[model samples]
Target: MAKSAPIDDVPTHGEGIRLGQFLQLAGLVDSGGEAKEVIREGDVLVNGEVDQRRGRQLQVGDIVEFGGRKARVSD
Candidate 1:
């Protein structure tokens, strides 16, 4: 099997965070507007699937990938 990309753990400030917000919190994007743009351009993934919903709720253990990097949500 091929090795998966490394995943960095990202802690949320609350119980959960929206995909767009998570992007910013994870330092994947510089701002919320950038997150929205990236999501709209199909540059974001959730749990290995392409997701375009900026408001998609993300919780612990959820994985997000962009720019060849992955981030795993942690409580």
Candidate 2:
């Protein structure tokens, strides 16, 4: 069995942020292209379900998982 990823809190400064943008802000990926690539390849998840939409809206409490790292949206 694989170890679960630690939950990290990500604070949003506005209404919400896009998945790709959030991934960059969380330091998950180095560039937008990278984020897009991973997301398109089904390497990212939103609240436990695979989400390939890079422009998916992320609000407070939304959970994002990528590369074994999990980030929870917060105020």
Candidate 3:
């Protein structure tokens, strides 16, 4: 089994940040366009479901995986 990376300083309560921004912050995808491409191709997963929206709001406790890297939002 592959282990996912840990997200530091997860937000407790907020409107949540943009999915693309989050991916960039985590150093997952190289650029916004790349993120969009990967998302549009249905290569990204959120909470075990395929999430193709680049602007999707992600909250704490949400799990995101892409490009063999995984991240879990923590509070």
Candidate 4:
């Protein structure tokens, strides 16, 4: 099962957060480079869609999946 949290959107911040930062913070991929590779290879998903941008910004409620693990952003 994937871990998810309820997040509220804030006007001050962008709808999505940085991909590399999110992976690092979640302890998913070890390094930013690794995350980039995974993303480039279509190994990651954002909101149920394959996303290949390492710098892609994930929204507050967006779901991120990689390596059979998933997480949702929350406040």
Candidate 5:
């Protein structure tokens, strides 16, 4: 039973947002290029599963994890 990192709530200010943009919005990565590279390298997780699509549409309540950090989408 290891303690998981606290999930941070990030506001999208819309109905939904792309995974790449959200990653940067939550301060997970510095730039879109970095986000794409990491995402393609299988370093990003969506709700506990690896997702490679940077354009993946994430709605409210979607959980994204990367580099031991987690962020939940919010409107």
Candidate 6:
């Protein structure tokens, strides 16, 4: 069985953050290149739905899940 990622509240020190960047800031991925790859491959989810846009703007309270891990945006 796959291990569940610990859910965390990651603070975004701004009004919004890009999906690809958030993946890195939240420690979901290692690099911007990896973030783009996973996002393009339909491996990333926003608020529980697959979001392919790497530049998708994320706001406070938004939820992101990838690679069995979950993170919530915070201001």
State the C-alpha lDDT per candidate: 0.93, 0.93, 0.78, 0.73, 0.96, 0.94
How do the residues 1-75 of candidate 6 rate in per-residue lDDT, one tens digit apiece? 976677799998766889999999999999999999999999999999999999999999999999989999998
Q: Order the candidates by TM-score, highest first — what do you get?
A: 5, 2, 1, 6, 3, 4
Candidate 5 lDDT over 1-75, as tens digits, reads 999999999998876799999999999999999999999999999999999999999989999999999999998
- Residues 1-75, candidate 4: write the lDDT tens digits: 966543323231444568877876776789988888888899888888998888887777777788777777755
Shift of residue 17 alpha carbon in model 4, Å:
2.4
lDDT of 2: 0.93
Against the true structure, what is each candidate's TM-score?
Answer: 0.90, 0.92, 0.77, 0.74, 0.96, 0.90
Candidate 2 vs candidate 4, lDDT winner: 2
Question: Candidate 3: which stretches are off by over 4 Å?
Answer: 1-15
Candidate 6, residue 58: how far the Cα is off, in Å = 0.3
- Quote the positional error of residue 19 for candidate 3 in Å: 1.0
**lDDT tens readout by residue for model 3, 13-32:** 45568788777766788899
Ten contiguous residues with the weakest lDDT in model 5: 11-20
Q: How close is candidate 3 to the true structure, as a TM-score?
A: 0.77
Candidate 1 segments exceeding 4 Å error? 1-3
Clashes of 5: 0
Candidate 1 residue-wise lDDT at 11: 83
Question: What ranking of all candidate models by lDDT puts the best one first?
Answer: 5, 6, 2, 1, 3, 4
Better of 1 and 4 by TM-score: 1
lDDT of 2 by residue, 1-75 (tens): 987889899888656899999999888999999999999999999999999999999999999999989999888
Best of the candidates, TM-score: 5
Q: List clashing residue pairs in candidate 3.
A: none
- Compared with the true structure, model 2 gives a TM-score of 0.92
Query: Which ten contiguous residues of candidate 3 have the minimum total lDDT?
Result: 6-15
